[model samples]
Target: MNILFIEDDMIESMKFQRTLSKIASRHTIIEAKNGEQAIDALKNSESLPDIILLDLNMPRMSGIEFLQILKADEQYKYIPTIILTTSENRADLLECYRIGIAGYVIKPLKYEDYEQKLTAVLAYWQTNELVKA
Candidate 1:
C-alpha cells in the first residue's frame, strides 16, 4: 500500500517508517516534514496514497489546517485520512472526527503496541478496499 506520512518529528517518523517497512511488500511511504511539504507532495504526485497518517502539531501549517484544505478540495477529499499523533486529547479526537478522519490513533510508547495499531489500521484499509471491490 502507498502511504502518506506527515509527521514533523523526524525520529518518530523514522520509527514508523521502519515498522511499516516490515509489513508492506509493495509499500511506498511518502515523507513530509510539515503540512506545507505534504500538500506540495500531494499536488506533485501522479497517484494519491491509499491512506494518510497525519500528525496534529507541525510548523508552518498544522495537521488541522492541512485537513481543512485537503477535505475542502473535491479531488482530494475522498482519500482516506487518519490522525496518528502523540496527542490523546479528547478535543483533538473530536476535531479529527468532525473533519471526517477515517481513524484516530494515539502514538504508543511501546513498540509492540505501535505495531498492533499499525496492523489494525492496515487491516481496516484492506477490508475497506475489499468491500469496495
Candidate 2:
C-alpha cells in the first residue's frame, strides 16, 4: 500500500514510522510535514497514494483545512483519509467525520497500545478496496 503520512512532529512521526515498519513492511510511507507539503507531494507523484494518514494539528495548514481542499478536488476526493491524531476533542472528531474521513484514531500514550492500534488500522485498510480514479 502507498501511504501519505502527514505530520509535523519529528518524534511522533519517527515513532509511527517504526511501528508501520513492523506492521506493514511492504508498504511505502511518504512523509509530509504539513498539508501544503502533502499537496505538493501529491502533485509531484506519478500515482496517487492508496490512503492518507493525517494528523489533525500542524503548523501551516491544519488537517481540517487540508481535508476541505482535498475533498473539494474531484480528482483526489476518492482517496480514503484516516486521522491519526493525539487530539481526543469531540469537535475535531465530528468535524473530521463531516469532512469524510475513513477513520479517526486517537494516538495512544503507551507505545504498545499505539502499535496495536496502528497495526489494526493498517491491516484493515490493506484488505479494503479503494476507489479508483
Candidate 3:
C-alpha cells in the first residue's frame, strides 16, 4: 500500500513510522510536513497515493483547508483520506466527515493502543479495493 502521511511533528511522525515498520514494512509512505507540502508532493508524484493519512493541525494550511482543496480538484478528489489527529473535538470529527474524509482516528496516548489502531487502519485499507488514479 502506498500512503501519503501528512504530519508536522517529527516525534509523532517517528512514532508512527516505528509502529508501521513493526506492522507492515512492505507498504511505502510519502511524508509531507504540511498541507502545502502535501499538495506539492501529490502534484509531483509519478503515481498518486493509495490513501492519505492527514494531521488536522499544522502550519501554513490546516487539514480542513487541505481537504477542501483536495476534494475540489478533479484529479485528487477520489483519493481516500483518513484523518489521523490528536484532536478529540467533536466539531473536528463532524467537520472532517462533512468534508468527506474516509475516516477519523484520534491518536491514543498509549503507544500500544496507538499501534493497535494504526495496525487495524492499515490492514483494512491494504485489503480493500482501491481505485487507481
Candidate 4:
C-alpha cells in the first residue's frame, strides 16, 4: 500500500520510517512535512495514496484545516485519512471524527508501543478492502 505520511517534526518522521522499515517492506511511504505540502502532493501525483497518516499539529496548515479542504473536494474526499497524532484532547478527537477520519491513533510514549500500534494499523489497512477511484 502507498501511504501519505504528513508530519513536520523530523525526528518523528524518521521514527515512523524506522518503524515501517522494521514492520513491513511491501508498503511505500510518501512523506510531506505539512498540510500544504500534502495538498500539493495530492494535486500533483498521478496516483493517490491508499491511505493518509496525518499529524494534528503542523506548520503552514493544521491537520484539521487540511481535512476540511480534502473532505470538501469531490476528487479527494474518498481517501481514508487516519489521524496519527499525539494529542489526546477530547475536543480534537471529537473534531477529527466529525471531520470524517477513518481512524484516530494517539502516539504512545514508548517506541515499542508506537511500533506495535503502527504495525496493527498498517496490517488492518493492508488487508482490508479500501475505496478506489
Q: Is candidate 1 or candidate 4 better by TM-score?
A: 4
Per-residue lDDT of candidate 3, residues 1-133 (tens digit) = 8899999999899998999879744888999999999999999999999999999999999999999999989999989999999999999999999988999999999999999999999888877877332
The whole-model C-alpha lDDT of candidate 2 against the native structure comes to: 0.91
**What tens digits encode model 2's per-residue C-alpha lDDT throughout 28-127?**
7899999999999999999899999999999899999999999999989989999999999999999999999999999989999999998998888888
Candidate 1 ranges beyond 4 A from true positions: 130-133
Question: Candidate 1 residues 1-133, lDDT tens each?
Answer: 7789999998888778778777755567899988899999999999888889899999999999999999998978988999989898899889889998888999899988998898888878866963244
Give Cα distance to truth, residue 118, candidate 1, Å.
0.8
Query: How high is the CA lDDT of each candidate model?
Result: 0.86, 0.91, 0.92, 0.91
Off by over 4 Å in 2: 131-133
**What digit string (tens of lDDT, one per residue) describes model 4 on residues 1-133?**
8899999999899889889889745777889999999999999898989999999999889999999999999988978999999999999999999989999999998999999999999888887777333
Prediction-by-prediction clash tally: 0, 0, 0, 0
Q: TM-score of each candidate?
A: 0.92, 0.95, 0.96, 0.96
RMSD of each: 1.7, 1.5, 1.4, 1.3
Clash pairs (backbone) in predicted model 1: none
Model 4 residue 118 distance off true place after TM-score fit, in angstroms = 0.4
